[model samples]
Target: MGLLFGSFLNVVIARVPAGESIVHPRSRCPRCGHQLAWYENIPVLSWLALRARCSSCGLPISWRYPLIELLTALLFLACQRRFGWTPELVAALVLVLLLVPLSFIDLEHWILPHELTWPGIAAGVVLSWPMGWGRVQDAIIGAVVGFLVFWGMEWLGEKIFKKEALGAGDKDLLALIGAFLTWKPLLAVIFLSSLQGAVVGSLLLLVRGRAGPAPDPEPGPESTPAPPVGPEPVDTGGEEKKAEDEEEEEDDWEPGPTSIPFGPWLSLAALEVMLLGPLLREVLPVPLDMLFAGAR
Candidate 1:
């Protein structure tokens, strides 16, 4: 089941940002446009059997495909081990479903599409209904508080630094986490995500001179900007086209050499809190107990 869901997640990650229907196109090779057969789409097994190449075009498939399938399977297994056969396990797995794709999308595009986060926030709250009104209330408060906290930081950072400090999508993602885990552990979530992201970002900056993943190549000529060396595109469309282009440039914020996506870190911290909370609490000192105040 995990593998099956993970396969679907790959489609979600690929199509959601592009505003494409995940269902309509069916699985196909991007290079060759060869639609995959049922047998050719069997998660990791299919990848292995094909030797990581597209059968039609012989183009090497990306390693990310098999990795996502295995990663999702392991996370599902961990959730079961942590929560057992319980209602809470269902919530945990759903949270996993949300986080994996968001993390990958942020890593690639530096954007977390609202298509996923907003719906995920609702799912988190809805999933808590089975636990009674108190938990539901907590989930609601968690979502609100989670969003407001990041929003306040974003506001303050702009006033102080005169630059954007956080992505707008971050608040939504945190709200999603809060709905699932409640507001009690939000401070810890923030602390853990920041600490881990900082440590990793610094190492990446030192080793590779950039803290973010390299951007994927955009398909088609329109996706790439015109080179300055090339003849300028005709201005026959007048000022409207220029204004639209400027608007696009203003909306898109490309990461600098040191910029790192926080979504993946947040997802990692959420998974750590959910799966390893008990072990962490037992091993951590008394001073850290406040961090896990909401641990089950």
Candidate 2:
């Protein structure tokens, strides 16, 4: 079942980014544009058979496809083992898969698209009813509070820092999580996720060096400059200016970098709560306990 779902997840990962339906469009090789046949799509078996290369183009397919499939399968099986054949286990597995896609998307593209986050919020709420995890009232309250808390923090952070701090996608993600975990754990998720984000973001900035002067100032009427005064000013002059631009671009690409995916951190927090939050409440140290006593 996990392998099968991973196959479907591949379809989702590939097509969702291109604005294509994961159901309607067949899977194709990005390198060669060859539509994969059914046999070629058979999860791990196909990857092993093809030797991790596209059949037609011989382009090396990313090992990540099979790895993700196998990883999700193991996670699903592990959740089942831990929680057994229960609605809670199923819901937990769903959250895991959703987080997998969300984490990878953010990692690769630095984005958490609405295709995942908004639908996830709705799915979490709808599925919660069927799973009997919480009442509709609880889920609804979770959604509202979850969104507003993050939104409020975002407003405050901008005022204090004079820069956009939280990504909007993160708010949507918390709202989705709140739909499943309810209002209580939302606070835990926020506290832990922010701590994780600060530590990880600082490391990434130290490594990536602040991403090219904050990315051209987010395009506004004021930020958008008037057209050049005269002709385009071609490079008829010195090699020095061109060399400077190349040096700047190279500096942007330098390595020794780290960027943590916050979705994974958020997912880990939610999973911890799902797995052992109750247990921890009984055993946590006084200082940590004091901070989240209201959650208890």
Q: Highest lDDT among the candidates is held by which one?
A: 1
- lDDT for each residue of candidate 1 in 129-239, tens digit (9 for 90 to 100): 998899999999999999999999889866765456788899999999999999988887888998888777767756775566755456333444322110111122132
| Runs with alpha carbons beyond 4 Å of true place in candidate 1 | 216-249
Best by TM-score: 1
lDDT of each: 0.83, 0.66
Evaluated against the true structure, the overall lDDT of model 2 is 0.66
Q: After superposition, how far is residue 278 of candidate 1 from its true place, in Å?
A: 1.5
Instruction: Please give the TM-score that candidate 2 achieves against the real structure.
Output: 0.74
lDDT of 2 by residue, 69-171 (tens): 9978987887787678876676778887787777766656445688888888887777778655445567778888888987897798667644334556777
